[model samples]
Target chain A: MSEDKFDAIVVGGGLAGTVAAYLMANAGLEVVLIERGNFPGSKNMTGGRLYTHSIEKIIPGFTAEAPLERKITRECVTMLTDDSAVGLDYRSTRLGKQGSDSYSVLTSVLDQWLADKAEEAGAQIIAGISIENLIVREGRVCGVIAGDDELEANVTILADGANSLLAQKIGMRAEFKPSQVAVGVKELIRLPASVIEDRFCSSDGEGTASLFVGSPTAGSIGGGFLYTNKESVSLGIVATLSTLVEGNRSAPAMLEALKRHHAVAPLIKNGKLLEYSGHIVLEGGYDMIPKLIGDGVLVVGDGAGFCMNLGYAVRGMDLAIASAECAAKAVIEASGQGDFSAESLAVYRTLLEQGFVLKDMKTYRRFPHFMDSTPRLFDEYPRLAADTMEEMFVVDGRPSIPLRKAVMPHLKRIGIGTLIKDVRKGLGSL
Target chain B: MMEYVDVDEKLAVDKFYVDEDNAHIVLRELGPGDMMQFHTLELACPAGLYECLPDGTVRFDYAGCLECGTCRILCGTTILEKWEFPRGTFGVEYRYG
Candidate 1:
């Protein structure tokens, strides 16, 4: 609670803020990180997996010390109907290889660990304080005004998350559109580690990541996800806000349905519900990125919409980490030059563009639009898979039919032309 | 209609360190037919705090709020008078976020 100015003030103690503070403070810059929650990740929720590539660069071999739940060795994508599920389950050693591996995480623990790392690197960590507004003087961002305290800094970073009111206050970002964001509700179900290993068919410290489409969302423009923790399971449903507003089913109800699904219920049987949390996800891909650099200020993480929801995978934390690295590099360079103007802060954008943060985003810029336009992926495709599977697997005392003939009706139902068009667009978007 | 999981029971299982004096979320006065627009909150709020009464009104409780900000985005300035994170350390703290 010092009135003195610091070199940099980082807002929101999520992944982005902590990483930026860690890097800046490690470079001997006086940095302060302000967190609204009692702790860094207390108010955070995720579908629960982090791609290790971005973070490995920041702290090499971080898996040894990080509070990661389990290394994901099995990947699944199940197209689920009410009573049927068609899934592709891939279990391979390649998935657990170093530098490419991912782990299921509880951010409440993971973010706190990272925040501690930032503090150990000599950053002033302040928790349990909401930043009311930015202290913008003469059109140049000075720092933040939290309650009665006005903390000044030569540079300010907004890592406040998807619903950043402070960034909106300074017009650095705009309010999220219902289409650009999604609502995710989750339940952490606790079970014995041995039970989880037996249920998910994994060995010790190994886990499975599963995604479901169709009935879990009641065939909406979203899906369901489940990640195996060491002694618990992270199960949840995510639906686009626009569709949730229009649909009759609530997110919690969808989650409950997912928990009750014939294929999913058996997986979490006898487990106790440990926690229930909900969050807004930035799913608009690259198109949703708002202004990242302004006079004496920078925006990172979900605040800048650095998230992507590919049908097979959802990524935000890694992008947040990468973006924070870029911002920190830019800030250190700016500090050396003694310039905090918008022009100098523009280096953050260039760094992101040159790195995986913006490159990957730009590569998949058309994805969100594709997912929005393609309704059949959620509804018709799952039903088609179920029907196709029933035709092939269900043995009845009837005349034998050709395999192609058995699947022809389902294909005709979805129309071959429409399927081809969707395939082409999906591939092109990717 | 699909059966929804009992939200109250689900919320009861979670933790909320409530700040009784402050209601972080407040509703604006409703005009004619404004209640219809609020039915969306019933669908969006994961906590199930926003309830549309049969008598053409809405009932809300901030105690169980997950602070996901869905209602804030969906309603915006139209239906909400004020929506801020309950002063730090006073709202829902996810034990395993």
Candidate 2:
């Protein structure tokens, strides 16, 4: 046991933990961060792209020095059937502008950079040590216990990732329901920088992000994502655990099928597989947020279920940054008053509620339900799009009719009433 | 007709630093109908570490685990006797995650 009690102890050295350590240590507080991985990101994985809006507020012009892959200048959404694809590709300079910018990131490099920033700010980082238990005296968390060592602190922050067993151990959160989370399996495929740019239709230092519906998950309640990196591409599929458990396709099989799909095979024709990874992402939205603040304790990042998936955009890093900021602010305030009680720490929730973290989550609260209930979005819609596209483009000896007349039969196959109902529910949820 | 790669071939590209001292995951003894329950792991484990054997049993190797926690979240304590991440500096490391 250490007799010297630090001001704050952060468990798990990922995005949220490192950010909190950086903030508190920068404010001249005694902070220590513990990581179970050999380094910061050895245990992390993502789809994954980072929205720069929140991180920009933390480190202005971060893209200048950060280990970022590429600025996303092109956006694509493709509806794919087994043999056909209908895509909407949008490219504009507006996307690369300051606040709206995003980048595809590989966390192994990004998280190490963040840990360096926190260390530079005077936070002591202890790596390769798993926290075995929380030191709770009279219902208040005072520090953490790792094996035979007990490190004491005035406040403890749990920034552990998606499967936060520590929070559940303390009764602060419940076990994950299968429907509340999704599994993402990814492959990082290597290609030459020039080859990637030529294939994705991008200039140097810029890339594209594409999302797929239909054939990727084989009619499951999930989708596929692809992000172009400097010399590689991140491609994966995410399906809800509930749906995955009930389905016949294994996650690895789904990824294999996605790679072999005609719509995707050409993009990585000669590429070599660099790394394959898997992770669980919280998709339960606002309703899944657990008890965040307690006496001398706080939860941030995926531990608190701070991730959102809006069909077109998937965000977790931004929300992790914002939540860490709010928690840091509240901790800094509490440290000044020497009051680390639950009442004093309640400011963390207040700050999150007032900021975009909670506001944006609230706006899209029903989206997960909307997706889970609508099966046709993954099945019929792609078939309909593919059939309609074939009607107009596949030229046989037959004369083509008017565009509406040609498309109406395909629409009728899905029933106008069902289509209208789905649209209404989808619009209402969004 | 597209041919798919085997799960082992897909996982071959990944790297894992194993913990020799610890068996991070273990399966409980199977009773009647337990094999079917264990078979779900064969369908859901991203690394395909679990296999239902011909003798009405399941086999699992934790060496190549991605530590994604899908098995833990799905099977809970039912089929798994013990499950935790490999102690520090061990388990699968994602170089390009």
Candidate 3:
């Protein structure tokens, strides 16, 4: 068969791949974006609140034309014990306005839009083609072999989502251990617009994104999330595979249990279940990120494990978009020099390192381990707080002691001194 | 097998928030272990399409899926099934995914 060569061949047409392809093509380079899916976004899902800063940086005024569900106005963090929860909430008027914090979106729609942008910018996107391996020539990367066809390019980009086999095949990413990744299962339950507004307590076109602890997984490491969409709620559970396997549990069941949680049920109650999906997320943070660049190849998005789930908000798509832009910029520079060797592609890693992608990952590298070591924050503390609250509030004809006095014993029972130490460690890690 | 505690029972013991308006609700802290758990959950769902069979079961299909989450979300209360897209990198490629 004949080889079809181009200035660049981008494998896995997700956010990172699409953005890179779009940028390259717009800069007047020949680019081919290969996607294994029938279409862009057909198989993608996220708890998915899109951070607009990076996206707007790539495509200015995106909020006006992007398929946005709602501008997030409220955010909450809930600590749970099987049946009850205590939460911290933040809501601001400024957050509800456009071009502000972020918007909750479905990746399917958003990705399709992005791919179209790439197409409009003159990149050729071929969907439903599975790329089996990378074409490495003379120890310098060259292109990709999809089935029987060899597609050559000056540079090839692997944006093939979190489980990025292309990167693995090319030796850029090592075989992933269970600890280096996360499994997230999400349900898109269709609720009436009014119900969603009333349930989450948001005004028209305003939404809330909340994170949960406890009920989603039995004592395993991971959490649950719920993000309000235009007419539905995206609810899901996520946990580590090693822990799940060690604990002998299942993820879908865990997601159901999360939906069954008292705090989550009413919001989803009576809502029709529309769609459910899941995907593995690279939670390896900075420590697990693989070699990002090599001869004729660059890695971006979850393929590079560029997500930061800091327990406040899950920020992967924004990082993916940023990294893709960086890769595109690097590829553009490489094309100008007519070189695609490791030296030329090293710019991708350099740009990412200088940006928040690597900087923030470095900052919070210790957080995952610290949180893992202290399971009590999820298991013990919530129970203690609940006990204290109950003891301090109920009136049953006993001598009425001061609320503070009533709760002191419960605090002692759970070892408040230890709790304080954990908090100190957590603050330091974060 | 130990009797599994109801979400409400667990919540009562832990002091998780129960929206009097809602049922079986509780919130807990997330740690590294939880993050790993999330990753596993994510793989099980795989683009939110298809079902995960019981242990030692393998299934793959390239077509007949409506891109729905039926088999996945409702496994066994519905019956376990697998409906995967192409291997070696297949399924949705969201520009934003």
TM-score of chain B of each: 0.88, 0.85, 0.22
What is the fnat of model 2 with respect to the true interface contacts?
0.72
* Docking verdict class for candidate 2: medium
Instruction: Quote the positional error of residue A197 for candidate 1 in Å.
Output: 0.6
Q: Write the per-residue lDDT of candidate 3 for residues B9-63, one digit (tens) a residue.
A: 2112211121233211111233444444333322343332222345523233323
Two-way TM-score contest, 1 vs 2, winner: 1
- Winning candidate number (DockQ): 1
Q: Estimate each model's TM-score.
A: 0.98, 0.97, 0.83
**lDDT of every predicted structure (CA atoms):** 0.90, 0.88, 0.73
What does candidate 1's lDDT look like per residue over A148-168, in tens digits? 889999999999988888888
Candidates ranked, most accurate by DockQ first: 1, 2, 3
Q: After superposition, how far is residue A22 of candidate 1 from its true place, in Å?
A: 0.7
iRMSD (1 decimal) for each model? 1.4, 3.0, 10.2
* True lDDT of residue A391, candidate 1: 90
Winner on lDDT between 2 and 3 is 2
